[model samples]
Target: MNNKVITKEAAAELIRDNSTICTVGMTLVSASESILSSIEKRFLDTDSPRNLTLVHAAGQSDRNRGIQHLAHPGLVKRIIGSHWGLAPKWMEMISGNQVEAYCLPQGQMVHLYSAMAAGLPGRLSPVGLNTFIDPRIEGGKMNSCTKENIVEVVKFKDKEYIFYPSIPLDTLIIRGTSADPKGNLTTDEEAMKLEVLPAVLAAKRFGARVIAQVKYLVEGGSLDPKSVVVPGDFIDNIVICDNPERDHRQTSSWYYDPAYCGKIRVSPQQETSKAPLDIRKIIGRRAVDFIKPGAIINLGTGIPNDVIGQIVKEKEMESDVTITVESGIYGGLQSGGIDFGIGRNLSAMISHQDQMLYYNGAGVDITYMGAGELDRNGNVNATRLGSQCTGAGGFIDITQNARHVVFCSTFTTKGLEIELNDGKLNIVKEGHIKKLVNTVNQISYSGKLAVEKSQKMHFVTERAVFEMTDKGIMLIEIAPGIDLEKDILQLMEFKPLISEKLKTMPMNIFTA
Candidate 1:
């Protein structure tokens, strides 16, 4: 067997200038940072490989790890990815019109990679219809600098679908925990194996170089066959990262945790709220009212995580619903913050693509996600907030397909304060910024589309509950002790269709 072992510098040399590189990562869980950073380092030193196009399914970091190293203005000409919350520096550049960024649904991206593996024209699906990704709504362009139409909406069988043009991809940057002498890779120690196989197959099928970064390199045939994910035939070079602790670990604050890898299940501990009850807990408390039993549910990071945490802490919906993140973990303990992609004691784990396929097929019964801004027409802007882009991770995929959808957010933001006074809610001080806007910065999810599909949608805020009607959003429920005209309607930029059967929110939700 030929030894595929090579230094990172030697591997980086293989990538030429103006190359298109596709990476696999779900928010830094299992990523090839050593290889990518090596390429970025080489580019900075030699100024070669400048103007490269980078593709990724999930946004991969918090400005310090993953693609942030490649965030240099000239290093990359364009970026195509699902989410950008983790990559803040690149987002700043995008907001400043320094680089071209294309945001796609995570499910469509995974399937597009599959299409690339099969040598197809491109992915054609309705996953992005009527949303910002729709050609009619900026065509997935993140900035004014990106003018080329990478995505187009076309009619297929009398139904409109978004078609992403296939770009000839050449270089693949991927990571695994171990690789044999022949380069068969195994990700035994990684958290979630996201976008690895499709990327490798696509790279090999297109006659591009595949560089495998691993923490351990062993002799040929030493790795178990079942453990090997990427075959040696598909891999061209192997780079061994000696210090995984420094080089490959997910984050800087902590190393590997057993709960993340499913090594052991940690029971969620019920803790009392010593701190003041904030907007998140209140929204979480109200959102749980929508969760139905025996449903396949998905929750986004941040507020959604808090909602699930509150559910578990209160011993509610413990067995009624199967919770999943876009990372493919099904019905396990939902993680929080940076470790948002994995689960503990996973009842099942599917490839992120497979999970997405299920979601795009309308397999999800319900979903609870967060939003940054909302318009009178019920459109949502969850990704961008006045140039701060938190790319739509699975926002389009989940909201577009789920049978029932709930968007959680405070009625307003920026210095928002609330007081819980003996089973009644009080807005101690109103927030200066109203999230109920005249028009969202970007339409991540289309309310018009949701109504067309006959989907049940609800907007849950700290003090109000809203529903989507045929015409527009209707105020259906207001929290107790909150005035209608003075508090709710006065705060919103536009008056909504008020429900004649308007009711007060359950006071038990606020009594704590």
Candidate 2:
């Protein structure tokens, strides 16, 4: 299984025209930028694979720059990914019908790759049973151009499960922090856990070629055996990308700078507010309720950022709770909010593969995530909207395994205003649209699975608290001074089952 180690250009040559390629990266964290660049250069120089199919857990690189460049003019014909917001230009192409796009749940994509690697016919699960990902409703539909194949629906233990078939890969492209001369790779610096080895194994099992991009090369035996995530036997080609600054989370000893937020472009409809109290700080405090002492936790981007800070404020659980970022940093204190926090005490900062393996196996105790929309069935749609959405990022892997999951987001968006004063919430302006909907454009997480696993799940927003029940999603409480009809019902596309004992959330959150 000796493979060839070559330059980026040499690796790019292996990707032929009209090929079905699988790239390994979970979000902007572990993407193989150099290899993507090589592919882009080849695509621009020659008319390569006109009908290219991309299969991955996450979409393109940060901000969609890499995938955008490759799929721009006549390069890519179609794309099948869990999310595509990394590249807004591609969304434009999708909207125009110039490029085809298919959206699947992020966890489903990971399971698909796992099935492909294990030589299974496909993945069998109840994850997307009655949701949009179900074969019945467009079969994980993304746009007019792309459509997924829903193999069948079968009864198991008198329950139903939808079968999503495996799609073969012709090529697998991955990025790693370092590799040895023999092709062993490790990604200790990335944030999110990616299915790098699974991608390579799946490609190889199907007789597909594997292309890897690395930052440095070490001696054959230098990499600790325990740390080698991708062995040389599984890799077919290696491209050395010398740039080290691209990695988002570096070693704690090193001075790490947060990724530039770029431009803060809020949707015109999104309401902006400034209060004496940072809403993010309060949100972080609320997340602390989900944390348990001596538990490992994964924090998603956005509102979940507050979890780390809130957890730190308690200070008592600092030694007990281990906080990790999906970007691959483990241990220490993880700050919450957009800027993200640092881990104070340290344990082990492992690579992307190790993180995924641990999380996928349900090694984590709790995970906090932010959602764009959640439905009555408990399906989460954080990836796509009408024409724009970010990559699934690490939402799938983290939530799938965590014992307890918390999704925090405002109940409504777009000029819906609320004020907390004198221990009461005052509705300033009604939000224009409902965030909790009857159906979502995409299924990023399955509520049914949460119920099956008896996982603790909560939907926390400023206005209400809801939980998933066997019957459906149930409303447990409303914020203080919030009207059930005016604030809750008017803001939700669907009515949640309410009990006579439903209570008003305490204004003094700490006392509640």
TM-score of each: 0.96, 0.78
lDDT of 2 by residue, 291-368 (tens): 767888887777675444444545456677777775456664453332242333335555444565677775578888
Q: Cα miss at 8, model 2 (Å)?
A: 2.5
**Which number leads on TM-score?**
1
TM-score for candidate 2, residues paired by index: 0.78
Q: For each candidate, what is the lDDT?
A: 0.82, 0.68
C-alpha displacement of 387 in model 1, angstroms? 1.2
- Which 10 residues in a row give candidate 1 its minimum summed lDDT? 268-277
Error of 1 at 413 (Å): 1.0
